[model samples]
Target: MAVITHDSAVRRQLRSGLICAVVSATSFGLSGPLARGLMNAGWSSASVVAVRVLVAAAVLVPIAAAQLRGDWNLLRRNASLITAYGLVAVSGTQLAYFNAVAHMEVGVALLIEYTAPIAVVGWLWLRHSQRPTVTTVVGAALGITGLILVIDLRSGLTTSWVGIAWALAAMIGAAAYFVLSAHGDGSLPGTVLAAGGLLTGGLVLLAAGAIGIVPLHATTNPVVFQDFTIAWWPPVLVLGTVTAALAYVSGIAATRLLGSRLASFTALLEVLAALTFAWTLLGEAPRPIQLLGGALILIGVIVVRRGELATPDAPDRA
Candidate 1:
């Protein structure tokens, strides 16, 4: 009876984690399209991400405070982790991705950033001595092949080198997020982590802007979405509420429940979601070749998940 109860509990947690993961992915997938809408209307990448983080922080910090219940020591213990997450995972990733969307199509840029799983495999081998298997290598190859197709070298159009570089940076940031968001070692509560990170990221971005390190240029020009122009704040509002606040909190919660490895595997769905949103929101229809490449990337991600199952770094879902 005890074993059955344990199994039932595990299953329930798994189901909840999956639901959270899906919510996070779909919400995150909307970010690029919405930010692109703003960028098209003269909003700088830094500005878009800054406002997004700041607004999300405003909404989440109170909830996080309640969750803390005045346990100041918990924050002191996890200060560095939260700060790092805020800078790299939240601000840096969003800034870079917004810049990528400014230069290239949303789907293409997101697909490039989605290659972070391959980078994680390499990181583990070098940093943790977790040598990857043949399966991972094959997956990496497929991913690279798909990336080439996604780049569409045969199209003869001048590809944006800057966009690709920015997307690669976002990929690194995402890899950092996957590594840092694990719930092992009794880290900060998921709500606290997400909220604190957003606050830190927002402040850092604002400081950088104040000092002229990053541009804060923005326009009040209406943003064009699909076939109509709408007030700018509406999409920006959604960017904060749905994408950053809801997505980050749920993603961290899912990671805590599902473990980083499985959580990241679930996050592969973001690529599909991004493509779908881009197609529907921005009319950025993906080419057939790009769709094929996307399939390859998904398959490669699946292969990476298979490799993760046997690796020591993937902690058991707790």
Candidate 2:
């Protein structure tokens, strides 16, 4: 075996970290579209999420075990936070987004879920006494405005209350993930937390399905499948492996490297990416309003990035 140099090791770590971040974003961005596709094929939101989480847990468990080998003690100490992170953060986000797309369009659900960054900033300000700069405030405003424009909230309110509610729920779940994950000590690698969290969330979903909290039978059963929406194994595998497992793993890596603020801000890119994917895959042409909303969202991200760079404390999520 060749001996590793310090610089070589550092470079390798950096490269690995960057790849993780990109993969995480890509996985997350694809989730909305895939869920929408699956649902259209006759699957229910509960079934889709339950299967995705269960599969993700299976893939992530071994990897997390490797990371937590000597660190089992940390898992017990942070059990509450870890469980909450998985349940609220991982499961909540997935279920909510899936439900939202079941009613509204994928782009609309994403526009709402992407609002988590601002919520995170607000939480830091109110709870931890972190002050927001002018740029941060503007970014928040812009993001909200863009979201409203993209989803045409006023029209949607009259159209479908369930869809709107599901999207908002997704935002809450996404925000929980951001806050809880950031608060954890850097000692626990995100991969381990993600594994534990996905496992917990999957269990919760499974239990909920068994007890009839969610109609998993309807979604998972073949009767739900139709001509337009077949239970294709390829898409399901992609959803479980890359989107769930790789996405969470990479997102945490980005958080570790770019800092939660920058990482979260960069994550907003998913909205645009999702829109692009929908357009290409499903041939869903966006309206003019969507175009404008997408532009504003991009601008808001730029403003947030600028403020994050200016505020030293913002980068230090812990």
Candidate 3:
């Protein structure tokens, strides 16, 4: 009876983790279109990111404080990890991605950035000697191939060297996100980590702007979404609260439950979700080939899952 109960508990945890991962992906997928609207209204990418991080921090810090209660030393203890998470995962990732988009088609840039999972696998192999099983290698290959198809990179693939560099940087940042989120054994609550990370990221962006490293222009003009123009704050609010706040918190929680490798693989769903959002919210219809590509990504994720199950003793670390 105890064994059966233990199995049931594990199943429940898996189910909840999967749900959180999907929710995180969905929320994150919304950022592209919503930010695009703001950009169209004359907000610079740096400004958009800064506001998103700042607003998210503002909302989450109080909650984190409440969660921490009197145990404030968690922040001091995990300072370095939180800083890396903020600078690399949150701030650097967004900045590099937007910079890449400026120089290349969004689809192409996104495809390059989403190659982070493969980078994650490679990083684990090189740094921690956590060699992937054959199934993992095959699944990574299929996932990358499917991503290429899903983005439909047959045309408009032209990009400058600088754009490629930025995309690669974004990929590194993304890999760091998953690896750091998964490896931390500290006692900090996920909410605290998310909040602290956002605050630090926001400050970094602000400092960068102050130093004239990136242009930080912003506008209060109404944003056009699908059929009509609406108040800019509405979309920005959603971007901060839902996309950044909820997405980061839930993503960390999912990573904690699912482990880094599986969680990163599962995050491939963000591309499909982004495509779907583009179709519904921005009226960009997906090609049938893209639909097939999405299926292949799902298959690749399943393959990776099976591989991990087959190698249960393998530690998940990078």
Candidate 4:
């Protein structure tokens, strides 16, 4: 009876985690089309990201404080983790990715950054002595292959050495995001982590913009969607509340439940979600090959999940 109850609990966690992971990926994916619209309207990428982060922080901080309930020790205990998450996982990754985009094909740069999952797999193997099962390795390979096809790298543009370096740096930061989110005690709620990281990262981005380290530019001009022009603030608000705040909180929650390995693999769905949104919002229809790639990504994630379940004792520790 005890064993049956434990199994039921595990199943519940898996179901909840899957839902959170899907929500997180879908929310994160929505950013692509909207952000592109803003950029086309003369807002710098940094400016868009800054607004997204700052607004999310403003909205989340109050909730985080409420969750803390005057227990300041939680904040003090996780001070370094919050700083590192803000610096590396949030702002630094975006900065490096922007630099890489300046130098290489955006698809290629994204592919590199997404390689962070592979890095997480390696980290677990080396640091936690959790060697990936053969099935996991195969799943990762399939996932990478699917990404290459989805991103259509066969016709990719030239990439400079500097671009590769920046992308690699982004990859490291992306890995940190998964590792940091998954490696934690029960004391820190996902909202608290999300809030702290957003606040710290938003301030860093604002500082960088002030010094011109990252160009800051935004016009009050109305932005256009596929059908009509809308006020800028509406989309910005959606980006903050849905994509930035909700996405991060759900992502951290998913990582805690599913651990970094499975959670990171599942995040590959974000690419498919982005493609779907682009098709809907920008009329950028996906090719047949991209559809196949999306299917492969789905299959790969399933395989990875099965592998994790098979090896129940696999250390997902960071």
Candidate 5:
């Protein structure tokens, strides 16, 4: 009976984690369309990112404080980890991606950034001496192929070397996010880590803006979505609360439960969600090939998940 209960609990946890991961991916997908609305209203990428992180930090800090119960030592001890999470995973990834998009098409930049899962696999193989199973390798190949098809990169090959470099940097940052999020030993709540990371990342963006490293233009004008214009605060509010705050926290939780390898692969769903959002919200319909690509991505995710589950106790070294 006890063994059965334990198995049941594990299944429940897996289900919950999968749900959280899906929610995180969906929420994250909203950022592109929402930010596009704000950009149309005269907001620079830096300004959008700065406000998104700041507002997310504001909303999450209180929840983190409550979860911590005044235990500040965890924060002190993990300061470096938190800083890396903020600077690399949050701020660096966003900055590099935006810079890449500035020099290349958004699809091209996103395709490079989403290759992060493959980078994570390579890092694990090299640094941790973990040899990926054949299943993992196959899944990764399928995922990358799907991503290429989904992004339809044939039209965007005019990308500059500088843009490619920035996109590669973003991929590294994204891989760092999954690895770091999965490494925590539960000494700190995911909420606290996410909140601290957001605060630190927000500060970094603000400082960069002040130093004129990035343009920080912003406007209070309303955002136009499809045929209607809404108050500026609406999109910003959703971007902060839903996309940044909820997405980061839930992503951390999913990574904790699913491990870096599986979690990162699962995150590929964000691309599909983004395409759907673009179609529904921005009137940008997806091509049939893109829909087929989405199916391939789903199959890749399932393959990776099965591989991970089959080797749940696999050691770093064969």
Candidate 6:
């Protein structure tokens, strides 16, 4: 009876963790197409990101406030980490990704950003002086190879060297986000952390826009207003509420449960999921190679998940 009870509890936690991961991935998956839609509608990448973060923060602030009242003192203690989480993890990931997409194909940009898991593994190994097991190396290699094949980066190359540099910069920011967000101390709640991060990021972006550091020219563009319609607002709302805010909250929860390194690796599935969604929602049909690459990526993730058992007591690498 006792053994059965323990097994059941373990199973429940696993189920909850998996659900959190999937939800987080699905929400993130929505961002690519949605952002593309906004961009096509004439919004600059920076504008879109800035608005998304600020609006999402506004919505989440009330919720986070309610939960964080009694634990207000905790917030002060983890102030630095939370700020880092917001400025780096939440804002960094979104802004870098948006900037990358502006300069390169969405798929290619994602391939670079999603390499954060590999970065995470490297960070852990260097920080702790621990060698990666074969499982980790193989999983990381397979995921990267599969992502490149799926994104079909070879055909997209042009002489646009500046764009390429921006995309690489985005990759660095994305990697930083994954590493910072994986810090899982039981301080502030995930929603609070997300809300704080969004607020910080939005302020930074807004400040840059104010100083002409990040361009905000869409406001003066006549082309942007001629086609404005109420149809867009609903989708934008969903993007902010469900995809950005809720996704960040749940993703943080999953990170807390599964730990960062593993969670980061598992989240790579968002790339494949986004590809599929883009195909279905935006009519961006994927090529045959992409399908095969997606399959390989799935296989690699599975292999890594199974490998977790081999290091049952290992601390979370990220």
Tens-place lDDT digits, model 5, residues 22-127: 9999999999899889998999989999999899999999999999898898889989889999999999998898789889888888888999998888887788
Comparing 2 and 5 on TM-score, the stronger one: 5
By TM-score, the better pick of 2 and 4 is 4
Cα lDDT of model 4 by residue, 254-274, tens digit: 999988998999999999999
Candidate 3 pairs with clashing backbones: none
Please give each candidate's TM-score: 0.81, 0.80, 0.92, 0.97, 0.94, 0.86
**CA lDDT, every model vs. true structure:** 0.79, 0.72, 0.85, 0.91, 0.87, 0.72
Q: Quote the lDDT for 204 in model 3.
A: 92
In model 4, residue pairs whose N, Cα or C atoms come closer than 3 Å (at least 3 residues apart or on different chains), thus clashing, are: none
Ranking of all predicted structures according to TM-score, beginning with the best and ending with the worst: 4, 5, 3, 6, 1, 2
Q: Of 1 and 6, which scores higher on TM-score?
A: 6
Model 6, 142-250: lDDT tens digits are 8777888887877646544555666666666666665666565566688888888888888888877788756764432222222343355665677788778888888
Per-residue lDDT, model 3, residue 135, is: 93
Candidate 2: pairs in clash: 41-229
Model 4 lDDT, full chain set: 0.91
Tell me the TM-score of model 5.
0.94
lDDT of 3 by residue, 75-117 (tens): 8988888898999999898888878877888777888888888
Instruction: List residue ranges in candidate 1 displaced over 4 A.
Output: 1-16, 94-113, 129-169, 306-318
Give the Å error, residue 281, model 6.
2.2
Winner by lDDT between candidate 6 and candidate 3: 3
Q: lDDT ranking from best to worst?
A: 4, 5, 3, 1, 2, 6
User: Could you give candidate 1's per-residue lDDT for residues 1-318 as a string of tens digits?
Assistant: 997997688768778987898899889889989989999999988999899989999999899899889999999988988988999998788778867877877657766787776666666567666677777677666766666665565544447999999999999999777777764475477878889999998998898889876789999999998988899999989999999999998998777776655566567767667778999989999889878977886786567556554554444322
Lowest summed lDDT window (length 10), candidate 5: 309-318
Worst lDDT 10-window in candidate 4: 309-318
Best by TM-score: 4
Backbone clashes in model 1, listed as residue pairs: none
* Model 5 alpha-carbon miss at residue 101, Å: 2.3
Select the stronger candidate by lDDT from 4 and 5: 4
